[model samples]
Target chain A: MSLPAEERVVVTGWSCLTALGANTETSWSRLLNQEYARGPISCFPTDGCRVTEGAEVVLPELPWLPKKAESRLSRASRLALPAAREALQHAGLLDPAGRSKLGHLEMSLSTTATSMERIEAFVRQVWEGKSPIQQAGRVASYQAQQQVNDLQTFLGFSGPAAVVSNACAGGANSIGHAFDLIRAGLVDIVLTGGYDILCELVFCGFDSLQAMSPDRCRPFDVNRNGLMLGEGAAFLVLESESHARRRGVPILGVLAGYGHTTDTFHLTQPAPDGTPLEKAIRKALEQSATSPSELGYINAHGTGTPFNDRAEAQAFTRCLGANASGVRLSSTKAAIGHTLGAAGSIEAVLCLKTLQTGQIPPQLHTTDPEPLVANMLARPGALLEKNAALSVNLGFGGSNAALLFKTP
Target chain B: MNTPLSILSWGAVSPGGLGVEALENFQNWPTTVASEVADPARQHLVATIDASILPEKWRMRPRFRRASPISHYMIEAAAQALAPHPQIERNRLGLIYVSFIGCSVYSIRFYRQFQKDGRRFASPMLFPETVANSPLSHLAAELEIGGPVYSQIGDKSCWSSALRTAACWLHNGDAEQVLVIGAEEFEPHQLEAFRSMRWLAKPYTRPFAEGAGAVLLGKGPHSGRPSIVSLKDGFCFRSRNESRTAAERCLAEFAPNLPVLDSAVGWIRPVAIAALKGRTVHDGIPALAHEAFGASCAWDTIRAAQRLSIHPEERVLIPYWGLSQQIGAAALEGTP
Candidate 1:
């Protein structure tokens, strides 16, 4: 399954703004310390909901945005643009004009909620009769494309862009699409990532589903409850190995393979048997041509919900077989909360860091590991024999995505 | 260059009626329906589907009944496309669901309930459907498609992107067959927005109607199907000059010498016309302005398939300019 050198996609630059920190370095340090960033929700009122805590990103200001653009863009877009800008700068694509000149650059963004805060504001105005029906048109324009348009305007980019809205799997799906595009020689450079913001709409919705934990999320634990919501954004600069070599840029890690599958068994729940998740993991391993024994770490999609943790544990056992005992498994969601759409990308960046730094972050707050995952990380950090790792994300709509990465 | 893919089957649910036949019939004799918007002072003409026309099985399914109307439209359209090949392996099929705004009505309902009645009153049933991927998941569950399912959120130009993605999936062996669907359901907020934007014509114009369009794409030179000669997308044209440049570059690759059939809608028509200046291009094709918001691209592709089916020796270039800055163009060659 080895790909041609020209077709192999690698991550050259990456940036993440998670609840744990504003940048990758800070977040990595916090994770290393087993810090939990969950606190009482301040972004919106949670008077009637059982869930009161969340992992929120507190930024001083989006200095890169123009004053005029700030008023027009949504809060989610504000969070996303800075991360994208950082990624481009890290990749050396940013120029003196505050724009990237790389020809044929493409962008694919993923999100579960695109500017829901703006939509809620507009709707509130409409409900209060403060705004006319014509003014509500602004709400109509609050789709995922608005984020792309904002990024394009801010970066002065003129290329193809797409929005992948696959719930929590969006981040991984965006990166997967970028990999396929570059691997197929469709484009040389792609800026792909995911972002979401805390909003009343999603909060109340999750509350209704009873899918939120009252306390800090504890993944892979026997006493695990539901998930805690979080807000953040992450972006990666993915390019073909040949393209990276031509520009003499540093490669952070190789995006060896990706696999996407749907349960089709339920709309909001994973298949109890975990067959769908196992298939996705197997497909990713097969595509990357890496044996399960070679994988050093497994960033499980441990949402902390009882069903999700149990199902994912079953999947690990079924897919890894005997190698399950050797893999160091952990879930960053315990530290950062569930970023939903941005979870996969943020975790992927963490995987790249783990590969580069050889430090496996601990699975915070898990007192007792699920029996199925024989090698769940209970300590602070561990060294890896092989730098290859896997990050998995399962989202609403039974969407599952797995990404495989190795040290460059 | 890669080998072309075939359009094995297609289904559409348009304003005129249901199924691909309805789309074809409406193309010959167009009709319009009266629709009301949030601005109660006036009534805007729209092409809306009659839900009663959908098959009983779809309407009666428990999941379908609980799903949103937009989900129903996509499922019905996909059902039509899949009806032709019942023997195809469900696991080998992939689905790419494309839409501009997904289930706005449900989103509004969920949010409105939460705002009015507080968090405890929020509806769990509606929350899942509010996400853009809900419809794709429902369609997959109904069809039992376990392969890779993706939901692409964009305007008209998404059609080209969807097609390109479907082709990529085929080339990458992700799925043996892929169903590319573009769908939009009429909601009061969307109608209000379109009216406010002045995109809707007065008196419920022809060709512009609410509908869903679907096509089954597979690696080709298959029997009795037109081959997609070349598909290209990801052209961002914010201005006329940029549109012209992107169009010129795209045409140079897909159809430098062949006669083109332009299918751009709304503000993008001029850009497409400018790009095809001084070239052998056809422009009299009826616009699907009455179809649902995103249906124009799918309708145009269907029209391209129809034209190629008649003129097997010709290659037609279809250029798409979305309301957003996204631009896409495709070349389709007929086969006999």
Candidate 2:
């Protein structure tokens, strides 16, 4: 069945921070030139976290500091808050120097040891017989809403807020779900992105899954290892086109449409043949009302695992057929480690930047590509003289999602 | 664009309990214990599925299988819900699944294994299912459904909000049938963690009286019989107990003499209120709730399903609240 002919969803703003650089332009610029962002993960000592190496985003030393905030924010949130702040600025949803009406959404996996410390303290409190204070500490930390409560109390956002935690698809899923809130008029402006701090819980989880690459993730490459876990956040400001037009907001790209599905075949293994994934692409295409031929670029969910790249490749081949080669595709993970939940949004911002700049980012270390996607990867982030791009993401539990973006 | 929505057929395996029994046994459900998905392993099963039963797929190299029998409970619940619902074009139906705590047993297992000997016991296959949203995502894939599939993990209040989101999608012509599921499986340890954190009450039980419900929401009607009452409207409130007050607050303002089905929705929430409310209503079409089977996640949907045979004049208050302190209070109007 074809997509229902209806209102076109458009991208309004985008932002990202990755190993390629601290901003979308810088990241995509180097990405298009086939530069690799692989480096030793030094932000935290990766001593006991299993395998090493990742596309770790190098935080640029900010010369200026805002003197107002007094609370300690996790690194992932620090990355996300700024990117979201900037995205809203670009969309004119947030005044450059002031606050604005906005709904906030986030998709995250594990955060660092912040909660661990709190829980430990709570344990200590109970041991010391400070039961009431201990109870209070446990209540706040174990509560999922604490994150948003913290965000609201810190950023002063009075609008609607929701946190989505769907593993790898978290970021894109957040953006996709957030778009609905906007289209449905729940909110005029929204900030959708993802965050995950480098944490041992996550480290152990991935290690147990054997999904982590000992070396750099070589997505679509025959010699691929697994995935290099990365830490960072990405955000996008999505506004209704009518609102953007009236306010004359600077549109970065269109949020377009997204497709989400679960394979259900096995919770972890992708539908080895890619049936659900193929269906996901079709659904996304149908939702966006964009055609396979119109998609000029793709940010692949190339986690560099044996299963993911292969599954994604087969899914792409099924979705695009010969048109698959016509679209330039690359895995930003080659530059930045897979940000788990943040990968989708960060890559989305990069894809938007690619559309805005007309350059498809290049894939580095793509030797001996998977046969199915070999031809597709060879074109690695070629310029899209015409501007429509799609980002593909899949996560554990057989989730497969796709998003289409268009330049304004 | 409000695309026309066809109420595709629906199938469900919930604790008001199986097939037409769920609809037929709508009166004071005899027991508070929830009906669980029949365990396939323990039963002498005639394998009708021609497809090679890859049951072992759960233990794959990259294994991340949903633990706690509830994941599978939700799957069969969904399979049942879809089986009876209008078979919408597979291409257009979408799945929306929600839960409060995602798959915790795997995390529990992972932690125990690591604590035992980090490398010696790590099962790759058991790892991925440890994350939230895995079951919803997995169920869609397993169904081979080619529709827009999504999931949300919210506290009690978002239970109705999740439905509202599905309705909004339908209103926007996004899909035909939106599969809404709430499933949860508890690891004794996870509950232990909750207890340590004071999130739980005591030596906990599955609270089978609380969980297990799935619903297919679209524009159409059930095949054999007309609905007892079509769900009219629902709003979210703050807490389970607070939800009752929110419903009471709404119920107070409306015509007191009007026919209303007062049911307490939510898993393990405002527990004995149902019995108390049932006693208050006396013999009239008292109420329906998921208090029998431990709550698998859904709050109001489970309660709403119980009133399928109620009259059109009956107004159903489905107050589904969440752990996040958000409350949704909505009313379902029975129609001619």
Candidate 3:
């Protein structure tokens, strides 16, 4: 699956902000220890809500961000700015020496809602007879690209930007699109990933669907009820291999292949047959020229919902055959609750970290695993040599995507 | 340089009316403007699409029964672009939905119910459409297109990004053809926001409008078709003062010598006009509807393609000055 040196895309740097911690290293360390981030929802009222537990991030202060425009920035942008800044800094793009390439850096980020929380507040104010004119900034930030705008303006990146809003699979879609851009030689560098913030509207919507777990997020567990919502942002600096080599920066991993497909079956529910998901997985493997046995780890979309986990497990079995049980599998959602739009990118960062550390993140808070996934689920914390890893995500509206990352 | 893409076909649902012919015959259509009191102190001028203009076949489809108006406009446009080419493999067709303000009508309605009925009684039906991708998924399902599908959100200039993405898809062999859609639904809150920001044009001067536009793109030089010659986007600006410079720079990087299809209106129109000074610029605002957000660019692109079709030896350039942050330009030429 390796492309020519000029076309090969590599991950140069990555950073994430999750409930487990404010940065990638902290989240990864806590994840290995099986430290779960679920707790009582504190960002907003959950008095009458069925599921009260969710993960919320406490962001660190970013002094470089202009203070005058702070109020106009959405919580999603606040979370994304620090992650992208760290990513750029890690990739050395923040240095004056590397600043010349900023204009060529295309941005592909994803989110379900940019500032839905602010939009809710704006609507309520309008209902209370408040002037819509006064709260107009909130409406401006409602578009998901507002976050991308914030990142680009703050970081001084003047690249063509795309904001994916494919619900849960958005993050992976953004990254996948970035890979496509690089492989097509449209841009040599890209700032990509996804971010979402927990809002009452989204939380209530899931609760109304009875898709929120009443107890805890237990992915692939026989007793699994549903998912717990969470908020965070993750970003990666992607560059063509030739660009990375010219810059002499460490190539974290090779983004070998990307496969995305749509399941036209339903808007909210994935097809139980998992045929579309299987197609997505097969496409990724075929594109990468990697066998199922070569995949060392799988970061499942396991939302702890019965429908999602079952379908995903079926897809793995259908696509991997006997190799399904051989590849170590886990859902980081067990540590940081289902981040919705941010899930795929967060897990992509986790997959790269997993390959780097050779540490498999365990499926936490589960007693009895579902029969379909029992054989492949990771047991506790285990270190093993890794070659390539897969991160798969299924979104609302039947958007299914799988990303394969290989060691460079 | 990116691979030049050929436009196989195009479609639109603009303030003028449904289908690209309406845009071609724009002078005959009356401007339907509504005065709205989005702010008690100020009256806003808005141009909304007539729902009755949607074809009965598209309007009555079971898949679109509960869908938002934006979805209806987008699907209708997509149908116009794809229906004629039934021979194209569905599995080899990709879709990209681009928008600035997504599904605001549904999102506002969903939140209103959530507020009035409390969180426990929130309606799940309206919540799904609140996400920008809802309509895109519907488009894929109704069209039975199983290829790669995505929803991209940005300003008017994002059209350039979507075009580039579609070109990449076509070039990668992921899909033989890619459908790019730019759509926006009329919503009161959106109007209120524009009015509050003083971005709305004077009534009848260049009012903000809503609608959808779509184009089917493929690789190679198809004779008699309009092909994208070059694209230069990502001219980021931090302020109004910087926008003119960005537009000029983007134009220079694109094809500065070609006749321009301008996608700028409202306060940013001057920036676009200044950048292409002395050039033969076709102001599409009069024909395609002014200040249509994402659709503004789409209409301009579709019009440029039409122009190229009629004038086979000519090349057209488009300069897009978005409401905020960025500028972009695209060049198109009719194939020999």
How high is each candidate's TM-score? 0.94, 0.77, 0.95
Q: List, residue by residue over A358-390, the lDDT tens digit for candidate 1.
A: 898888888877788746563686876796999
Per-residue lDDT value at A102 in model 2 = 50
* Preferred candidate (TM-score higher): 1 or 3: 3
List candidate 1 stretches off by more than 4 Å: A1-7, A130-137, B27-38, B196-198, B201-208, B239-262, B279-285, B289-291
lDDT of 2 by residue, A303-400 (tens): 88988888888888988987887877788787778887788888888788777778676777778888887777735536676568888888776667
Q: A312, model 1: CA deviation in Å?
A: 0.1
Q: Write down the DockQ of candidate 3.
A: 0.60
Name the Cα RMSD for model 3.
Answer: 2.4
Better of 2 and 3 by DockQ: 3
The superposed Cα distance between candidate 1 and the true structure at residue B169, in angstroms, equals 1.1
Q: What would the per-residue lDDT of candidate 3 be over residues B154-269, giving only the tens digit for each residue?
A: 88778887887888888788999999999998877665566656676553237667788999999977999999978777787767798878877787885445777756677777
Interface root-mean-square deviation (Å) of every model: 3.1, 7.4, 2.7
Rate residue A70 of model 3 by lDDT: 69
User: Which is the winner by DockQ between candidate 1 and candidate 3?
Assistant: 3
Please write out the lDDT profile of model 3 over residues A277-304, one tens digit for every residue: 9999889999888998898899999999
**DockQ for model 2?**
0.21
TM-score of 3: 0.95
For model 2, residues B1-336, the per-residue Cα lDDT tens digits are: 122222233344443454435533544343422111222122111101111222344423232243444556566667667775444576677777666655655655665575456553466656556666666655665665656566565565445556656765665567766877766554433322343444434332223232345667665444422232222112223334544544454344333444344444333344425323432331344444322221332433444444433443444444443444444444444433
Alpha-carbon lDDT of model 2: 0.58
Ranking of all predicted structures according to TM-score, beginning with the best and ending with the worst: 3, 1, 2
Best by lDDT: 3
